[model samples]
Target: MVVERKEEGKEQLIQRPVYYISEALIESKQRYPHYQKLVYAVLRAQRRLAPYFHEHPIKVVASTPLANIIRNRDATGRIDKWAVELGVHNITYESRHAIKSQALADFLADWEEAQQPSSQADLRHWTLHFDGSKNLEGAGAGVVLTSPKGDVVRYVLQLRFEPCTNNMAEYEALLHGMRIAKEMGATRLRCLGDSDLVASQTSGTCDATDANMIAYKRAVDQAGASFAGHIVE
Candidate 1:
């Protein structure tokens, strides 16, 4: 497994190689199903890079429907065990495409192997942007959800509950946006928000000390776990 840090360049995004891990498969293991091997690779990488996986959302770029296979309701035995083990981390999968970086390309050249193409249903990736504000007038929130097909849905809400803080409103917006996206059948979602605190709290990078904040973070985690792939940024 290889990890790269993405940086915006003058005209394009640059992928800087950061970490790499490799394991040789035994004879019996090498004969496992293609999807199982992919999942095992991911699990091995996560085990070795627990800190990175815990702090940031890791995107697994592959040509297969790894997320669907692992998250399937009918998954059993070892697959179910892999799902449970991987459920604790924030992970998302994207379709593999052209590699622009020479270093990355070289690193992945030998690792590339043909796999079954992902289905259209498994290729759907949604983008969600949410914001919340508290002013003397009142507290309200807004969310914008964009489908994979470029369709957009906008939502606005006014918080009627008393004693709402800006942070609370931020959590409310994020939670509300996630709920709406799930209802709309979004399984792979990328969440964007202006509140650094909210994002950090939800991603488990920052500690939520307040009771309300802790409760809100818990709710967000639960809501996020329902999706096959999701990231909060």
Candidate 2:
């Protein structure tokens, strides 16, 4: 596949694709007893996701609605307390997932359009992005797909990389985004990446595929299965 510096997707890269773990909002109950139960439940999930959370390092962002719990109450304490019971050390993590763009609905619509089979309607296009961050280092990936206007989109995830290479990170960002978009029912997709290796691997233009790329390749292939048309740029 010839590499071209083209922007064919519907959404321009006002911001490049970034795939990094972000904070999640944990709703709490007003009743103290129920609140304890909810806190413990969240802690259980935290424990299951702990290793990834620690390595990828996304800060756990949680909140108790002020109406349910008083501001004076140690909300963070709830997590900390249960974490202790669950054997999670109070460690550093990223806390930004709780904040996401309001464009999720719009983005999902575009993904659905690209996912339909080539039968009646014209093939459509959409763009997906991923950014992976660790400390001062980071990488980004992007893809475009179309899906139904009302469907919720999902993607694959890469938990961690020990030494962390930029190229792999870049590729994973794209793979991860593709997985989610496909899961969300995207039909047609154009995978995008700033990294030549990532684009090449997906486009079959690069023979430099490595062992680490196997899983990502599978996700990309599977994501593309739903799409009647797809591309990479």
Best by TM-score: 1
User: What stretches of model 1 exceed 4 Å from their correct place?
Assistant: 1-118
lDDT of model 1 at position 32: 79
lDDT of 1 by residue, 24-100 (tens): 34344667788888888898678657888899888887889898988898999667887898989999988778544
TM-score, candidate 1, is: 0.51
lDDT for each residue of candidate 2 in 119-142, tens digit (9 for 90 to 100): 543345555645443344433333
Q: Which ten residues in a row have the lowest lDDT in candidate 1?
A: 109-118
Distance from true position, residue 62, model 1, in Å?
24
lDDT of 2: 0.49
Residue 214's lDDT within candidate 2 is 61
